[model samples]
Target: MTNYDEVPYPDFIHPATHPGNMAAIARLHGVNAPPPESCRVLELACGPGGNLISLATLLPSSHFEGVDFAAGHVKTGNAMIGKLGLTNIQLHHAKIEDWVTHPESEQDRFDYIIAHGVYSWVPEEVRQSILAICQMRLSANGIALISYNTYPGWHQRQMARDMMRYHADGIEDPHKRLRHGKALLSSVAQNVPQGSAYRVALEEELKALDQANEAYISHEQFEDTNRPCYFHEFAAEAGAQCLQVIAEADWGDSTYEQVRPDVASALASLPKIRRGQTLDFFRRRTFRQTLVCHESVAVSEQLQSADMASMHFVTSSSLQGDQITGSNGLSGTVEDPTTRQAMECLVAEYPASMSYQELCEVVETEEPRSLATLQTDLFNLVCVGLVSVSASPTEVRREVSSHPRALPLAREQVLRGDTVTNLRHQPIRLDDTTAHLIRCCDGETDHAGLVERMVAYSMANGGLVEGDQVVTGEESLRVLVTAKMTSNLQRLAAMALLVG
Candidate 1:
């Protein structure tokens, strides 16, 4: 009915939805979460199983199960799983409410329960059933990640949604409805007064909608049901189901720095739910990815450095003078000398994670400091979101091997589409040339062989070109291909695509 079979939701991996990262956050909050390496994971409404499949490939020992109402999505995902020859994961075509009847659901409990992008989009009954499943199927100390839209940030988006629905009223075709809705919004955004606050908000929404794919726009803007609620209300609902809100998946979102000092102090004086609600009001958060656990589990309110000793740290941030500039456009300053040295170690190990003990050993070689000081500095970095902490290190190779082999999932994805998931559970778009190059990296082809295959591929597809001009000589073309191969290999390794 929603045109999901026609244009399925884009296959993607949400980094925050990764169980290892969730476990890290859980442990930071003093929950003895099950280890992600060998834990059982379940995903509700896991359309095409993109996120779960990636996790299964990365952690071979772990078992994964997904339930989706769409038969096409389940078929596509299971086909990919079969192609990959993975024995650890399966995607079932079943409704979320009926998942309790599934054999996997009846036999074992899941350590991590993920229900991303389903809460606000589904009906009230389905939403309650999702929470009920989390309570029934979750193991003791297991964490459940549930993402949904929040207010009052959505208030502006709601106005835009009303406009879109008004313009596309009575349109039975989903694609037609989406197109007309976007056109009306675009016209309004351009004609509105330039300096008005409403105009700015409209323009922002328009920009985001324009960049999204058709499937995303169809579900997000034109869905029949898009209910958003306050954080406190959502917490109350979860509490009624014997679950408690532990922490936000994105650590920085819940921090006090989002608002002014006085506002934060006022918020701190309120009850926990009231504090979260008031903070959301101050920050105007549009969406939330919240982690919940059994109500009996003791969640620590204060974070200590010792909590991080068992974790691994990863970052794609560079040391620019005293600032740590992350690839995600967020930056933080490293004023302390010891912290600066520690950041350098992390920068050198981008695309690969370093264990706490390994980082301590490396950082202390030149700048010896108290272990407590180092842990405290790293903890501050985590709070600021410059560095990501995970329960286990991602096994992505940083260096380019002579016979480089990408993960089978990425290699398979490159053949099917322009996007592939990296070891970090993030998508990377591949160009035609890069895709051709990656197809040749089967762990049996050397650098010279890769260049030869790429040259042949380019010549067969479209003649080789240097800069804006086509190359004339075979020797020059080979040389160009060699240079391109070297650069692309390093780039691929940096993107965490190369596994060997």
Candidate 2:
């Protein structure tokens, strides 16, 4: 096995794997899943427990367990769990093959089993063991999320991986291997003949590699085993284990908005697994986070309106006129009057999620509509990626407090680096100024005290300055720091990084 202690993969939360989101997806498909508020969650290959710990902070009532082969990862994750004073989550140092051997592992079936980065990266035996665990250890109605690299898209990435590994595999140092591998790929991309098909694919792969972190490149590209399978093949294998893929974890990406209506109509006629495979072939999907359940479980892709009664809605999108502009800058027009108003309400709630009933009440107050009608409209918006649904509400402060307290997990993260996990289990990269501001939030510092601390820190560093002019006077520096502090605090609040 490759030692991850040498070049540790950066651990971060994946919101799609959150039990709340998974439960919502389950409900959308008519699966009677365990509630996210009290669900038992297990994560395989959970590095340092970043994702599990973040979930623990949010859902204190739920229990989380993570299993990893690496001792260093387990040690680091256990240390964080201790510091956070959380009793509901535990990180264990154990291989996946050995995990099922434990008596407790077999006894306590998890409501959610997550294998985020494990499927495509491991050998066939390990992969089979993962599926077996999911089959035997998952709750009767549980949803196990397994993410993997798929074919078509992986076909291109495989070529790039082979070239990089061929050039850099002999290197002993992991970091050097990553550097040389990337350099080799870059050189090929630059030297390849213009307008050739290979050049086009290589350049696209290089573009993706450029966005990836060194840890990702090291583990994903340079690892000994990476087996990308077709969606149908994966589905068939899961079926062999008595598991069925219900749907993709990301509902929006699974929609037919990208394909033509005729293609979608043709796909809709096919069986569920075949439809998914055909869709993947059309989109050339490189990766998938699939939600699987017991083969006997009755699954329905047609979402019921009643399910929304227990759900909440949230989005970082802005309602500009009739168009809802996503956080990523993609815009979708909401033509229906009621849905447009509902979108307005969702946008106003930004980081804080509003319960489905609460949003419907507010929207109905302005524009009357049946609950079923409203839910259908909202589901459409969800499929379009303009909004998202959650089975449990995300607890976050919409208003900045007099003495803002950052989440303990976030405070711990800031000490390590600029990237901190928010209340939503999403990672937010902070600027130096914002990171400094977060470090000062301890619920004891008053607004004025915070400003004074920022002013002093700024002066000691290099003094507060306006573009060209360095402000030396105490009053001017205080005023500038105050404004900057206020903006930073508001930004943190909007990011759901603040607790109280």
The lDDT of each candidate is 0.86, 0.85
Give the alpha carbon lDDT tens digit for every residue of 74-165 in model 1.
88899999999999998988889986542364347889999999999999999999999898888889999999999999998899999999
lDDT of 2 by residue, 116-179 (tens): 9999999898999999989988988989999999988899999989988999867998888878
Q: What stretches of model 2 exceed 4 Å from their correct place?
A: 101-107, 365-369, 463-476
Candidate 2's TM-score reads: 0.95
Q: What are the runs in model 1 whose C-alpha is more than 4 Å off?
A: 100-107, 365-369, 461-476
Query: What would the TM-score be for candidate 1 when compared with the true structure?
Result: 0.94
Model 2: which residue pairs collide?
none
Best-performing candidate as measured by TM-score:
2
TM-score of each: 0.94, 0.95
Q: Please give the distance, in angstroms, between residue 398's alpha carbon in candidate 2 and its true position after superposition.
A: 1.0
